[model samples]
Target: MAGTELFGTIEMVDVFLAMAITIVIASFVSLYRGIEGPGIFNRIIAVNVIGTKTIVLLVLIGFIYERPDFFDIALLYAILNFIMTIAATRY
Candidate 1:
């Protein structure tokens, strides 16, 4: 039973790590799109998506690291990302 529990915990950790890596890769792709996009609107959208993915990745990292403080940062990032997206669209 103990071995099974340990295995489950390890599996969870692995999954979380995988998710983090995926998000990071996605962010990089978004960043590339944002940089190389032909139109301003497309670049803005890509940047917004990158910001959202970054917030999610941050939250996931906090969970993996067992630090709740990082969640606050993630929340701030979410709020800022939303505001920036709105501002970008308006401009």
Candidate 2:
């Protein structure tokens, strides 16, 4: 039973890792959009999307690693991301 439980945990971690990788790839796409966007608003929105995805990725990584501190870091980063977006729009 313990072996089966361990295997299940491993499988879940694998799933989290795959999700993290997908988020990374999507972030890259957002990066490209930010670079080549037609307008300032479009670029700002792209950057915001990347930041949001990064927050999700951080949480996923924290789950996979069983690290509680990562959650705090993710939260702090999320606040920063939000402020940055607002500031970018204002400026």
Candidate 3:
């Protein structure tokens, strides 16, 4: 039991680290797309997609840290992102 628990803890840490790295990379890509995109709509779509990805990444990080409350934040972010995307598209 002790060994299994230790291994699980290490795995969680590894997952968290990997997610953090991915978030950084995604942010960079989002920035690049926003700056180099051909037009305004493309940049807006890229940013919206980045927002969704960020929410998922946050949820995964919360799980890794053993905190369920973070899921609530992720849910709220998803809702807000959806609303904003729709608004942006309509305008």
Candidate 4:
């Protein structure tokens, strides 16, 4: 209802969907970096970046679907991602 009818022909949901797709593509690039990075720290940072992207993608999906629950899930994932990154760095 918020983004709808604002683009004259294109909807806000479409915009959000496009953003989500773009994020996915960027995540793939991060994945490549994670696999082919020259150093372990680079790989770890790439993985962390991917995780951050995932959280954003999740939020966009939740907005597109009009589900507040997704926000909570994304927040939980963010916490887990942070913990994992810290543990990986410590190890």
Candidate 5:
């Protein structure tokens, strides 16, 4: 039973790591879009998307590391991201 539980945990870790990596790669693409966007609207949207993805990555990291405290940080980041996007759009 212990071996089975350990195997399950390891699989969970692998899945979370894979998801984190995928989000990271997506963030890079979003960054490129922000940098080379055709206009201001496109750039702003791309940047917002990057911020959103980063939050997801953070949550995934917390899960992989078995750190529930990191969830608070993720929630804080999410709120900040939302406020920043609104502020940027207004600016």
Candidate 6:
């Protein structure tokens, strides 16, 4: 498949930063939901969503900095998030 469009490195980094900022802003909604949800289940879901976004944000940071090490941090956060969610839901 021949792609008809090409993006410069600077443009690609700009797009990545924009996407990362958008995701962070969007996660603020989930943070608010987690804080003010009417039910515990709703709050749990919101917190989980925030955790998911955090992991994504970590990877995005790695990409923005041109450091692959962030992927490991993201994976660790994913594991912690999963465990915490399971413990929270089970309790």
Model 3 residue-pair collision total? 0
lDDT of each: 0.84, 0.86, 0.81, 0.93, 0.84, 0.86
Q: Whole-model lDDT, candidate 6?
A: 0.86
Clashing pairs in 5: none
Who is ahead in TM-score, 3 or 4? 4
Error of 6 at 43 (Å): 1.4
Encode model 4's per-residue lDDT on 1-91: one tens digit a residue.
6666655898989989999999999999889989988989998899899999999999999999999999999999999999999999889
- lDDT for model 3 comes to 0.81
The alpha-carbon lDDT assigned to residue 75 of candidate 6 equals 100
> Backbone clashes in each candidate structure, one number apiece?
0, 0, 0, 0, 0, 0
How much is 3 displaced in model 4, in angstroms? Answer: 6.2
In candidate 5, how many Å is residue 75 off? 0.5
Question: Tens-digit lDDT track for model 3 on 1-91?
Answer: 1122335457546756687788879888888988899998989988897898889788877767778899999999999999999999899
How does each model score on TM-score?
A: 0.84, 0.84, 0.80, 0.92, 0.84, 0.85
Our tally of clashes for model 1 stands at 0
* Cα-lDDT of candidate 5: 0.84
Give per-residue lDDT, candidate 3, residue 74. 94
lDDT winner among the candidates?
4
lDDT of 1 by residue, 1-91 (tens): 1122335457565667799999999889789988988999888899888888999898888877778899999999999999998988888
Write model 5 residue lDDT over 1-91, tens digit each, in one string: 1122335457657767888999999899889989988989998899789988988888888888878888899899999989988999888
Query: lDDT (0-100) at residue 29 of candidate 3?
Result: 84
After superposition, the stretches of candidate 2 with alpha carbons farther than 4 Å from their true spots are: 1-10
Residue 56 lDDT in model 5? 89
Query: What pairs collide in candidate 3?
Result: none
Q: Which stretches of candidate 5 lie over 4 Å from their true place?
A: 1-10
Candidate 6 residue pairs that clash: none
